[model samples]
Target: MPALKINVHFGGGAELLFDKIKKREVELPAVDKYLPECEKKGWTIRELLVWIKENLLRERPELFLQGESVRPGILVLINDTDWELYGELDYELQPSDTITFISTLHGG
Candidate 1:
């Protein structure tokens, strides 16, 4: 059995969800095919967004906006690289892949 370890950075603490995969499974919804798998796994758009928001908020409260969604600012990095640059959420995952999500910071 293959297992995936996820460290969720949310609200004010880190949460972890470990899953055991026996067959084909998609962890993150990306590209086009991920939706079906994600839906099958109970991850809807709202849920996904909330998950990202909560997790990200935990790490950095300032990063999270009360009403605005976590798009264009929040960064999803996989293995120390931005997933959008590679393929966005559509990036595929293997057994030992580690995904990280964070908010971007800038200065003048």
Candidate 2:
């Protein structure tokens, strides 16, 4: 299966954790269409974070991740909307989704 493509934006110093690159278009890699959430739901935010850490993260992961979730104070938005309004890490990914991460801990 082809990788799932999505847009990622980092802001509020979150870009610093990603080598200062603020925007990225990433193909979530896998031979199978990753559907970790109830099969048809496709990749969840939880899985995406793991993918980001292993593939996109450039520096200290501690600043971006805490256990399995994004560290506290880091806000996650899916398609310009808050993840909390959805199901957070359990939220399934859709094609062409725009996921953004903003670090409240930086430049506050």
Please give the CA lDDT of all the candidate structures. 0.42, 0.86
Which one wins on lDDT? 2
Predictions: Cα RMSD each = 9.2, 2.8
Clashing pairs in 1: 9-55, 10-54, 10-55, 10-58, 11-54, 11-58, 12-58, 30-89, 30-90, 31-90
State in Å the error of residue 98, model 1: 1.7
lDDT of 1 at 18: 19
Locate the minimum summed-lDDT window of 10 residues in model 1.
11-20
Instruction: State in Å the error of residue 22, model 2.
Output: 0.5
lDDT score, candidate 2: 0.86
lDDT of 1 by residue, 1-108 (tens): 123334333211122111212122234434134333343433333344554554333444344443534445556555667666756544545444555545454445
lDDT (Cα) of model 1? 0.42
